[model samples]
Target: MQKVDILAIGAHPDDVELGCGGTIAKMIAAGKTVAIVDLTRGELGTRGTDLTRAEEAAKASEILKVSARENLEMKDGFLQNSEEYQLKIVKMIRKYQPTIVFSNAIDDRHPDHAKAHKLVSDACFLAGLPKIETVLDGQPQTAWRPKQIFSYIQWKNITPDFVVDISGFIDKKIEACLAYKTQFYDPGSKEPMTPIATKDFLESLTYRAQDLGRLSGVEFAEGFTTEKLLAFKNFDGIVL
Candidate 1:
């Protein structure tokens, strides 16, 4: 059981990359252990098949150098924030025991993304409860909850609570996102095109990061939101 320092949970395969690929890359470069959990195979994505997306996601993970990656095999477009879903999330939270967990935004263009956000956030809190009892293998697992859970902005251009400076990590982020060749812009692909398939959409992703970075006086970055107002122990942790 390898432990992770940061764990990112997404509704689909490419979500994490779109939301915070640069941050993950930066964290990895800073010697932090990061992992990703995709709740669905993105079977419903218009651009690619589940198998293709899974392969693409794997390539993305490799590019990001995530410590571990897994899929919950949840139904795409029909996911519910039910107890069953929460338990499944709990199992992974217990298994990974990360200090921080990043999840989908509270609201997004994709309804599934919002649902996943609620499910993952609720599960993180529930996992800290002793009565909710989820054990791993033969061992009675200790209740483990991430110190903080934040939602990464996606698709909707949400106002982020904070943005991480990922100046040097932007290229790595784009590399990871482009690994989903079947989903992104690829003239070579004979597949159908969608909102995300155009070259301009890809360019928008880069520009979005650049825009966010500029707001914080950085070359590139990723944005995220927190449920609660941020409280730091000291000013030393803040960049500005």
Candidate 2:
């Protein structure tokens, strides 16, 4: 099993990119190992096919410098918080044994986002239970739960419990997001224009980060809601 410092979960390919890519980039640059687990192939998206999304996800993973990226290939837009799905995520949680987990927003424009939030949260707890056994690749996996779980802000501007100052890594985050050429704003894309594919939405990415940064005293930032209250050992953890 490959252990990572952080594990990011998303309902679709670009969810993490749109939400917390800058935070992930910043963590990685600081020498923290990170991995991504996409819950679905995004087969039901209005813009692109599942295969293209997978390819784009790979590109984004590379750009973010994640240690590993996996897709559970779940049914898109119809995600359920069932034991079957929870166990699937539990396997990954046990496989990676990450100290921190980042998941989809609690509430979002997409129903799947909220569903994934609960699913991943449940799985995180279940993964810590030794009674809930999981087998991976002929090996018995041990129970492992992340110390902290956070949900990134997406589509909606739900006030974040905390904001990460990603001032310097914003460009890298945008670059990773644009790698999904068919998903985001593009003038030449003749396929179809969805809510996310519009020009305003792309611009919102920057403006939204800037707005949050303005409130938090930074050039750019990403917002997240924590499932558990955080306790800092000292004042050093606070951003000045």
Candidate 3:
């Protein structure tokens, strides 16, 4: 099994790129192995078909340079926080053995986002339970849990517990996000327009990062929230 420093889980194909692409790119540039697990193929998206979204996701993953990217193939717009789904997530968690997990926002405009958040969070906890038996490829998998789980900011402006300074990686994030050409700001296409396809929404990606950076006194940044209190080893670890 391949171990990863971080695993980012999202409800849809582009959710991770929209939420924490810069962070992932920055981490990978820093020599951290990162993987992506998309819960759905975004079948319900107005503009793109599942096949196209899958292709776009692959392109985005390559742009981000993630170690691996997999889709759970869950039904879109109807995800549930149930054992069946939790077990699936647990399998990936055990397989990748990531130290840190990044999940969808706890609350968002899309119902799947919040559902995914709960599903991943519950799985992370249940994955640590030895009694919760799971098997992968006919082999008994050992229980494994991530050291930390954080939810990235999405659709809504929910307060973030902390933010990462992605000063030089914002461009990479935008590039990865644009890789999903069918989904965002495609004026030349005759496809139906969605909230994300709006030019303003596309611009907001950068402006939002700029806003977060302004508040945090950085050039650019990505924000996330954690249920557990964050600890620092020393005062120097914090950015003033």
Candidate 4:
């Protein structure tokens, strides 16, 4: 039972990369143990097969240097915030026992993204209840809850509650995103063009980070939203 410092959950294979890869890269560089848990295999994606997505996800995880990556095998386009689904997420939370969790955006163009947000957020709360028993590997799991849970921005420009300075790690984020070659911009590929496969979409990754950075007074940054209020112990804890 290896405990991780953070767990990032997404609706599909590349959602984590698209949403918060830079933040993950920055945290990993700071020696924090991070893991990724994708809710689906992305079998319904138009550009690539499940097998290709898995391969690409593995490559991206390698680039990000995540401690572990797991897919929950949930239905790709039909994500549900049901108890069964919530329990599955609770199991992972209990297993990892992460102090912080990053989930998909609360609202996005893709319906699955919002659904995943609710599922992960609800599970995070339910996981801490001792009455909600769960078992993994033939053993009973203990109740656990993360200290913080934040939602990353995606597709939509929902205002962020706070931003993380990822000045030096944006390149790593792009590199990891490009690892999903079958899903992103590629002029040579015969695959049908999707919104995410466009050249502008590829460029948006950098420009979006830059825009967030401009507002935050950093070279590059990533935005996140949280339901609970965030507090700092001292003035020095914040970047000016």
Q: Candidate 2 residues 1-240, lDDT tens each? A: 999999999999999999999999999999999999999999998988999999999999999999999999999999999999999999999999999999999999999999999999999999999999899999999999999999999999899999999999999999999999989999998878899999999999999999999998889989999987788888885678
Report the C-alpha lDDT of model 4 over 104-190, residue by residue, as the tens digit: 999999999999999999999999999999999999999999999999999999999999999999999999999999999999999
lDDT, candidate 3, at 61: 91
TM-score of each: 0.96, 0.99, 0.98, 0.99
True-structure lDDT of candidate 1 = 0.91
Local distance difference test values of all predictions, in order: 0.91, 0.95, 0.94, 0.95
lDDT of 3 by residue, 1-240 (tens): 678999999999999999999999999999999999999889989997999999999999999999999999999999998888999899999999999999999999999999999999999999999999988889998989999999999999998999999999999999999999999998798998889999999999999999999999998989999979988888884578
Assess candidate 4 and give its lDDT.
Answer: 0.95
Model 2, TM vs. native: 0.99
- Model 4 TM-score, 2 decimals: 0.99
What CA RMSD would you report for each candidate? 1.2, 0.7, 0.8, 0.7
Evaluate residue 90 in candidate 4 and report its C-alpha lDDT on the 0 to 100 scale. Answer: 97
Angstrom error at residue 125, model 4: 0.5
| Residue pairs with backbone overlap in model 3 | none
CA error at residue 4 for candidate 4, angstroms: 0.4
